[model samples]
Target: MKRAGPWLRVVAGSASFALPTILGIVILNFLFLQLLPGDAVDVLAMRSGSATVESISALRVQTGLDQPLSGQLAAYLSRLAHFDLGVSTQYHLPVADIIAARLPDTLLLVGGALGLAVVLGLLLGSVMASLAGRWIDRMLSGLLMLIYSTPGFWIGLMMILLFSVKLGLFPSAGSATIGTRLSGLAALYDKAAHLIMPMTALSLFYTAVYARLVRATMIDVLRQDFILAARAKGLHPVTLIRRHAIRNALIPVVTVAGIHLGNLLGGAVVVETVFGWPGMGRLAFDALLSRDFPVLLGVLLLSSILVVAVNALADVLLGWLDPRILTE
Candidate 1:
């Protein structure tokens, strides 16, 4: 209970900062969207191949697009204050509803990717650190560096080609098997099958990154005075690495993982596009192409909130890992 005090304080601090950060992101997203060359009506005009001036004018007026920029921003803020995200100009549906439908898939992808990266990275890092200067460490390091340098979308495409086309092991593109009503574990398994390729592709780069970081940090931790003392006291090499070096080394990895969680959303744009996964990243991509500002803004806003929340959780974890951080 006493140890939890600092953790609670850290969480409180994170929560306080999150609201303003999210608000700033929302405002910036709105401003950036406004700066785009055209609006949804223009996209509609292009798609229809023939929109009369009168009809275009009517559409603009009906959708409030004809309003002054300031008026539009103010109206958006007003709706936001009232907990409304407005309707999507392209889909003709509530932006919140559309985003809510897609958010879970995005969460699943990001969560799975993060979990896989952390676990695999830790294992690889430990091996490399323990076997430092060995042939296996050098070989693994080179392989990971190659993966780190590769583009995530290309990796995703190649995996799809191999696993789906050549091997017929997993579905090529989707979050689930379409046109199926399978429920229970069967449905879960189907989704997992679809998720494997994208998840691995998305996670590989981060896995390499984290592996390198952990290896470096763990090597340093193992050489510290405390580790030397422990070793002199007859501590087993495996126990020393596991109980002391890895725990200390993990602090930085956790910090970096928090930061990377936000970036995963950006990467998800490409991965989801390549995989045809129905998620917020794909929604935002489609919205961007269609000039659907409402939907895009909503997606950005929600994503920012999620990022903030994840970072806050990371802070709490950090405080638990090293309560000295809160004091500092």
Candidate 2:
């Protein structure tokens, strides 16, 4: 029963977030779409086989384009309530189908990228903490600042130019080709090779962040009375740091890591655009360009849901890991 405490809280928190999260997504999508230079009507017209004001207007109403904002919103909610996100008028395909087919690709990319980022971040963070105020520590600090300041897309561009364009070492873009063979070991290596640049960019960027976080947390945890007591017991420096310091420091790191994962999912627009990786970020971008409202909304909804869900889970973990938080 005690072990179930955190999960039960997570479920409740996720449930509470549902309505607001949905409303926020609706409003966000609506506001952005409304603010665009043209609505779905004009967008559809541009891509139509035969384009004209009358043709556009007719198609608009056919796609609920004639409704008032309130009516359109009501219809949107009704359709969404029924799990019918409506077809992408532009793609002429169901939104669910597109998300289903593309979401795994996104999770694969983001998850791999995030895992690499965390490992690098933790290691560098430990090194930073170990060095503290020395020149190496200062250098690492400066490196973190540089990484934090640099944009992911810019790094991605540099990588592509150097590795793909200049050295001719790898493919310039895309996840994989239809004819690409995938057996067992060969397939694994092939995928890993493809992932190298993007993963490295993400890893380097987040390493700075994670290292900073780990450094801060480790410094704080090292100062704790328990850590002091462990040290007094003649604990080896490495064992003391790993078994006591790092383990405790991980609480805060876990929070940042969860939030970072959430951000990566939402924040991949630039990286995805650069790589043409075909994740939700790139899909959402394509939807926005073509005013594929259903696809855009679906992606938006997925991102919002993932962020809220992961954050809630992180909160629960935090609460459980540090009982003082819950007690207070």
What are the lDDT scores of the predictions, listed in order?
Answer: 0.92, 0.79
Candidate 1, residues 202-316: lDDT per residue as tens digits?
A: 9999999999999999999888999999999999999998899888778888899999988999999999999999999999999999999999999898888888888888887
Q: What's the residue-level lDDT of 11 in candidate 1?
A: 74
- Badly placed stretches (over 4 Å) of model 1 are 1-4
Candidate topping TM-score: 1
Q: Report lDDT (Cα) of residue 103, candidate 1.
A: 90
Give candidate 2's whole-model lDDT. 0.79
Residue 48 Cα positional deviation in candidate 1, in Å, after optimal superposition:
1.6
TM-score for each model:
0.97, 0.90
Q: How would you encode candidate 2's per-residue C-alpha lDDT over 264-299 as one tens digit per residue?
A: 876677777787777898888888888788888888
